[model samples]
Target: MNDLEHVKPAAAPKKPARRRFLLSGAGLAGALLVGWGVTPPRQRLMAQAPLPVQDGAVALNGWVAIAPDNTVSVVVPRAEMGQGVSTALPMLVAEELDVPLASVRILQAPIDKIYANVAVMRENLPFHPDDTGNTRAVTQWALAKVARELGINLTGGSSSVKDLWLPMREAGATARGLLIAAASSTWQVPPGQVRTQDGHLFHDASGRKASYGSFAAAAAQATPVEVPLKAPHAFRLIGHAAPRRDSRIKVDGSARFGIDARPEGMVYAALRMSPTIGGTIAGVSPVPVLAMPGVLSVIDFSGALEGQTGAQAGVAVVAHTFWQARQAAAALSIRWDEGPHAALSTATLFEQMAAALDGDDEHVYHSRGDIAAAHEGAKVIRAEYRAPLLAHAAMEPVNCTAQVSGGKVRLWLSTQVPTIAVDIAAKVAGVAVADVELHEHLIGGGFGRRLEVDMVAQAVAIALQCQGRPVQVIWSREDDIMHDVYRPAALARLEGTLDGTGTIRSWSSRGASGALGHQFVRRNLGLPAAGPDKTTVEGGYDMQYAIAHQRIAHSAIDSAVPLGNWRSVGHSQNAFFKESFVDELAHAAGKDPVALRRDMLAGHPRQLAVLDAAVRRAGSAPPGRAHGVALHQSYGSIVAQVAEVSVEGGEIRVHRVVCAIDCGIAVNPNLVAQQMESSVIFGLSAALAGEITVTGGKIDQGNFGDYPVLRMPQAPRVETVISLSSEPPEGVGEPGVPPVAPAVANAVFKLTGQRLRSLPLRLS
Candidate 1:
């Protein structure tokens, strides 16, 4: 028996011929009670039971709810944040269900148990050498079970669609099977005698048929079946381009983003806080803003200093409107305690990290062969590279709305992690997780910033203190910039030994960076240290190339500056460091950059395929339009980028970029291409202009004026070559991000004959 055989049908069966006729008459009576039954109070107080699927519909995880109308409601757990996942992920389900693409509707997923991505559990691996056998298998099993029961969905690590590819399709196919079974039983025929197309079920021999809506009630009572999914060759919509589901809405300003959510009886809140991150309000003087027009209340929020994980303390100005709140907040004055981060600065932090790299203390993440012997016998080349702090400058500033009433909480936010937001809100409201209901909204942009639900916590705290009134907390552009959990600065030193045959004999890399795992370790696992910072050592250590002798070590430098994952996590910085250094080595060996990478990666076909494709697309260009190549495999996809750039008047201008990616089976070729384009633009901005600097523990940049993003006029022409393969779709969002930076920098090097070692490439 297949997996579906295990699912028993509902105990109550429909009364065959008379059920539909009776239901039609009963619908008039039930219509009056529908609003009452589905009210917030009723839905919230309802016993926590398995979600009941309507007849002819199926629950594919909690996020996806398919209806008898042939409408597929894709519960998007991840914030759309302009990543196009809303369009791409639904295609995966629609392909297997064999439904018309136009019938699907995208829904922002609610906080539930079935929405969590299980791949993030990999972060729990032990980093120390002695802790090799760190209960990974057991932990994964436990997490999987918890995820199934709780539906704790996450939207980071570029694993959204790839993670749900199988389970989601299975859900759709299973639902289709049940519909066939139900129709067969109703017609007194074998299941094989019934056929389904679009939203209709037919019994050919009987010359009778009904729409799925008509049989929905009967289908809901039938036992589920494990139906086999169609092969890629059989897919009509999976790899094809359909207009993005959100395009019309977004274009016409009909997309209901987080900023667009306006709840009834909602009061807007603007925060006034210390410039220094982690600082707290020592005292608040409300006299300055008490008389301000539209100012309702001045609440002192001391919760930021309560040692809560990822908390921010501030004074909230509640007002009638967002503009009023902002005015009140601007007029209010408060004394601040700058906390332990008072002395922190961007320069000093980088110095501290650089100092750690020179020390003997280090963790060897991965190593092989004899590095010492290879380094001693061959011609060695070394280079040091650096990337400064960065921020996720999402188009929509951080905002969340919370309504706390009678020990129950409801929140609306643009968040990547709804489960975490619900938990935080529950903790803040002194309620259970089940008591907190989250309505996720479309993110203006996530990039990784929405992964933390701090804004949700702030909204909940304010709402809870307002005597059950709904509060909408809005973060100004300054609040977003000054208080952002920045992408940490990193310093990498690469040493490569090349033999007479132009082959790299040994590769040794050491990096020093703020530990990303530290926050998780300190808060969740209660560990003192986060061990080796994988983000610091990952690129060179986990190099896909077939290097004979290699050793990659990391020196974890603790810093007060808040750090979190950026677009491509460590690979964004590491790709620049590793790929740029590889190009340097190629030039030193008097070999082509493409040829050098191909030679080093002879054993890896996937890596070679992408690299070769990028190179072929680039051609053998020289001088004015110099070609630069870089390859990186992260989040399961191997991507190679070839950048063509021209340096004029000491300014680097990128003309075009050729990207070759092998992300398994392209679920939607159009979506993959769109993601690649988005990633390149995002990466280009970070490579050429992105930086989050600090002075006296305060971020120096605010909004797009100072912290600029890539504009359409400046965007380079991007072409994507997707490797057609039968392998499962790996990742698309972040994998495209890592290669663009290094490719551009390497191109700049060829154009000017100056190695641009650092990010935000400056020409002097």
Candidate 2:
């Protein structure tokens, strides 16, 4: 084998340049002081809690630091998994601190409750997007309070920009304000005479100027006080398109992911898990494979031993090389236990979900005016839509490098939740959470897959068996996909009515699927499954359309197949059902899809604006082209999309798409546009080629050969229009996803005259 390590750099640099600010120099007294004791969410949501701050650098609050190089560093708690949080968040600090984007540095912070992501958890509560009552306001506030106390640091649900929008700016402004106060005393000038620009403070009247680094010591000692923030009109960096900080390194192949980590004396490890979702290894005879090339050792792990953590059970093959380890893993003889789900099939899953809709145990997500009374005398419209389960299909398969010795463990990986990763690694290493070090690396892609730390636990477990030798455990692409916690396949039944004059009278929708909120709570929290997951019903009943008698609900069906968040989670499927159904209602009433949405969204100016802009931006499809439109809200943002589709010879082609979104302030407009285009391709992949089918308790397809992704040729031409708003920024990553599928499905019906309800829209 080639010497893969000969040309490589040294093993993971141990704590390269971490520093703690002393109170003597910064003279700051807990400037951004906040605290939270790690209280895992109970049957609600999951987040990594805080660990004690390592004693290296002088600690200011939890974020923001300065070095002698005139670079202002911001400690970002959220993970950057292809999203722009790493850049957008620092912009908030740089913007407030009056520094150039180039002069800023970002530090991926160690886990602490002070940095817990409260927005995603607050969003978990059952509050509709259009809900305006005190119940929603109070409930969100109360949940945020609890999340803060618990210090749950999570980064999913596209809430990174939203959560840190104000706090980061405040941190910058406070630090900057302290500097001004320090300068006020030094130059014998009132604060009004001092100003900051490009990381330098100047007193023009006194003709005195000093770089921020020159006075950082004194500024740290100054008292922290509240200061005014930049108005929307004055933002120079917040709205502007700054180059992504990680783009250069990523493009140059210099960025290190979990797969690149090579600790000193580290060996490669390979795993072969039971093909069945809940299957396990009853026993394994390792003697037969012990003589294989580079074979080190084999360790057994019960697949379900780490419940709620999603750790896969089986045996690990440790070897001198990954290829050697993989080769030996293929020869291991094992006794398999297929578990209770062995008999499960996709057909039976659908049947059971259908039966669940007919059963009495149903969870009502949203109910307003009486549906029975409105349907009694109106023209009823009915249809059913189905979406198949989906896998994350991330570019880099899940992998983790771990080392354990002397009752302490350290993990290096690309994970979305480091705090949770620490906890799970500790649990698997038979140590307390505090005895673990998580060195997070750049993610190849997350899309919610990294939210689960089972792989980390599995790697640490393998490292434990290696006697202090660092082990990097890698999952083959096949193993990653087959054992993935997939997005649930859902079935929705819709019934709506219109008045004699074609005005809407009532709307009722019922869906049968495994509720994500309940499953997350039940699986991650180790508590009783609680009420319905708002995530499941987010795009289902959260529309702001005007319907006097409207009822939207779901029948929670538990499928043996594992389920978790996809790009848009429930909205991914619900949007297709809701938007397509809305188009059907439009056809029944003989109204244009665009016009129907505009009228329904009259009371919601924000929703109406995006809907109108999308339709207008799309304008007339060129000759021989047809258009379809959809509008939906999720994660505190509203989005509208118009898909231009052309069908020929029974094959449907999406030529282009026009999208409009109102996510409050556009922290970075270019990033918003990039995400919109990204989501379009992702959604189209699911609409055209994506599906995860389980038969006899095993995934029928493995890898991209059968589970195809959208390629460059098949990707549609995408154009996006950003709605100008000064309100706090809302979700950007996932909102673009929900509208694309429905838009394409709606357009397909317009061109083919066939209402394709199931996904991968096939026409005969």
Candidate 3:
């Protein structure tokens, strides 16, 4: 008898005969929705059972713990995915704790409501990015209260630095104050006279000092006080080039990723999902792999419930080694119900979008004056811009290790959302949410793919049938690409007018595409999507130009294709659409691109500052090179870029890029530069080479070989200039992404005199 026969999968009642194995899966989801309403976020995080700790270590609070060996432990709730978050966030605690940054170590915290990411949800609301009026204020405050009560701890939208800035400082200061009080009672000195530095307290008059470790026990028992945080001028480590904390581990090969997880008695699994998007498992014949070498069993994976169906039914092959499992999976024969998506392709989707443009159901996101009247009186310029669907393609393909034993499940993953991961895994395993234990590891790369919990839930369903053995379900390079939650394909029809003096008098745009947020809310949260989803029109409407009359609206096209948050989300495509059209307006009026933008942005000092710095770095678009300039903001940060290009052998070759940004305060200049460089590479790849095509109701490209990323040799020389500021830090991870594509496209237009309105700019 097969080992899987003994395991009972989650319930998906009323599923087709082929998918009946996932019985009650929908019921569990319904239970989760019911639970979300009654459970407060604070109770979710603070009320969870604590993790087992070391013998001599002590839990100080939700975010920090101390060991007797003089090493201070900081409990980081955010996931680090090569964004330098591990180093940047910990700096906050160490700065306030008054300890050497090196003295602190990190422990990835467990699943709790406290870690739910409130900003991701808040930022996605249908409000203007710069909205600070009563409506925005009330909405934000209400969302914050709800998030706090529900414990929405998450790590996306480049919010780690801003979200934890004040709280981490307070936590550290509270700890420091308690330690000082403990020393005051013991040494009979005034608490005010006690000064701390390098993890030790000093009393000058008595000539006495004590290490933090010596007073750890007493400090834990003492009351905490909210001491004041340091002013910007008094900072030591912050704004300085502090070394990254995970450098040593990553360089020495000791760093662990999701794929590196190895629980004792661990088995391996390789899954083959339905080839068609949003399809389901119709039937499976496992005879081909049942007797293969090292093959333990051929089982069912209840399915991935991430986008349309949310739960994707599939078959899994488990064996002693991953390679063995993969090979066996190839040998098995399976049938699928491709559903309504059986005949879908990108070409067909574009036709639907074209039809939507002429339809009546347009969602007007922003409007000031009458666009029709503005266009009728002025010289009208019309152009159409399109962007193809994109994949996150993180360096590491998705993988998760899980085990369901004794009515409980443990998951080891590299996930951006731990709270959601816990819920999905438990829901799939048919176990209580509290019974799930999540062990988060350093992510190889996230981009935005890891934010989805579908892979984690799949691992749990696979492990549930392994007779108490741990199983690591891995998606090969092919599996990851073909089934990715893709960046929605977008089409925009832009109409603008330039006055006699070459000034942009009016601007209007109508975008038609699948709504990434619309699908997200309807599929993931199981909620009805009402009103405008801000993500669809964020980049197109939120620009800082000084046009007199402007209108931005999107004709919504409901789609079944899986859509997800790619690097910069909507800003990625919308920036390309908006900026390129602005370039077109400049040419129609016979004006210089940079000079034209400078005129429009004269009143916005921050936007103009970056635009000036970028132009200064690129140096006036000298003789041999064509320069294109673009400006956009995301996650509360402004970025401007100038791309220099030259045509060679009928190919557009970008030689260098000069970029500048004002993200409030640069927490760590080194990390900020790293992110800018990374974003340039990411955006360039999409502009020059990134394209995902669908045919025969399936993905045509499989891995890096067919879908090439930017190579090091092809990477342009990127210069990042960061401005100085005293305000709170804003996002840097995604701010740099929106400008690169348009900047390059604009330069291409200047070089060849052919205005390219589509992505993957190819010279015909």
Computed on alpha carbons, the lDDT of every model, listed in order, comes to: 0.74, 0.79, 0.80
Model 2, 214-307: lDDT tens digits are 6777776787545699999999898888778888989999989889998899999888889887887666777767789898887765532456
| Candidate 1, 534-642: lDDT as tens digits | 6666556778676788888888787687777788888889888989988888888888887888897887888898888888887866656888788998877899998
Candidate 1 versus the native: TM-score?
0.89
Per-model TM-score on C-alpha atoms? 0.89, 0.92, 0.93
lDDT at position 175, candidate 3: 80
Write the number of the candidate with greater lDDT, choosing between 1 and 2.
Answer: 2
| Model 1 ranges with Cα > 4 A deviation | 1-70, 107-110, 122-151, 205-207, 520-529, 620-623
lDDT of 3: 0.80
What ranking emerges by lDDT with the best candidate at the front? 3, 2, 1
Clashes of each: 7, 10, 28
Worst 10 residues of 1 by lDDT: 17-26
lDDT of 3 by residue, 1-764 (tens): 64334323433422111101110111212333344544443422132554345747665566666667768888788989989988998888888889988888887776555555566554556566556799676555545545555565677888888777776777777788888888887888778888889889889899999888888888878775446789989888788877778889999999999999999999999988888876776667786687899988877765333332256667789999999999999988777888678888989989999999988789788787778787886779999999998888888899999998998989889988787777667666667777888888999889888878778867876777798899999999999999888888999999999888999989999998887776665554445655576777778888878888899999878876788889988899999999999999999999988889999988788889989988887886667789988999888899999998988898888889888999887888999999999999999998988888888678888999888899988899999999898889988889999999899889888778888899988888
Alpha carbon lDDT at 554, candidate 2: 81
Per-residue error (Å), model 2, residue 531: 1.5
Residue 2 displacement in candidate 3 (angstroms)? 17
List residue ranges in candidate 2 displaced over 4 A: 1-60, 303-308
Candidate 2 Cα deviation (angstroms), residue 438: 1.0
